[model samples]
Target: MEDGDLLSRALDFYGLPKKFDANLVRSRFRELSRKYHPDSGEYETDILFKELVQLRDVLLSSLQNDPFAILENSKEDPEGFQFYKSAKQKAAQAIEKYFQFTDGNPVYLKKEDNPALLRLRQELETAKNGLEEFLEKFPKSIWKEDTETTLKKISVWFKD
Candidate 1:
């Protein structure tokens, strides 16, 4: 395929705009590779492009999987808020339940001790992580303040 076609395909895989600055990609990637790569300059353009694709994948995934991004994306209307708000709330509740069930317990413990509770805790942590990330990207999201407030409750654990 042509370079443009390949670039477009890469963009599509990462859910990015097809039209990006070619020179910027060249420069940014060159800089990034220098930092990330052990033997940087020896790589080919195809390799560079592959790295670019990987970068795009990471950035896109981070944003897409981000709960804040989800909220921001859905902010065009009221109904969008309903789904995001519910998810944010659910995540908060799950985290709370997780904390309650695991109160004063060792963090390194295995899930087999209480399989159902452990599973619930895992899900709750996952939801909270997603919500936290989502809130970061969509600070002005409909349920953002509530999400932040909920996040603060969880934050206390790591402090002590």
Candidate 2:
């Protein structure tokens, strides 16, 4: 699945001057770690402090490198706009039948009445309601105006 807004948003996330790609992200994180290292002698920084800070930056960059990183970045980026857009397009295709609804929807309830079904149902309801609430509370979400439309519909389908 490919998102229309992913490249733009990922670029912004890494504070890159240009568009996002695999190599630039690695370079950016490396630059950040190098500049902020405690051994740079710019300040009296502690080893633990530098390590912790740099570790987080490295991990975040690693997420970007992963093929699934775009999905991970979407949650933290904004209203999950880019992620949802790509997902919607993929879900609409007939070839995606092998992939389950990873968003944790309650579609399985129609097939069985097991305890797991109830739990998933609850989760699906929560995600849906949360999206609805988020949209109402945070109008005009960052980066996109219609961010709530798709999510709201997804959520409504889970209403119980």
Q: Tell me the number of clashing residue pairs for each predicted model.
A: 2, 0
Residues 51-159, candidate 1: write the lDDT tens digits.
6657655444443344453444453454345445545656666656766877967554344554546556555566567666666555676777777676676554333
Residue pairs in clash, model 1: 67-134, 68-134
Runs with alpha carbons beyond 4 Å of true place in candidate 2: 1-32, 35-107, 110-116, 138-152, 155-160
Q: Pick the candidate with the highest lDDT.
A: 1
- RMSD from true fold, candidate 1: 13.1
Q: Candidate 2's residue-wise lDDT over 1-160, tens digit each?
A: 2343554454454577443434556786566656655776345667644554544455445443332334434335465554444444432331233224334444443424334445444444434444454455446767234445656555543444
lDDT of 1 at 21: 32
lDDT of each: 0.55, 0.46
Clashing pairs in 2: none
Query: How many backbone collisions does model 2 have?
Result: 0
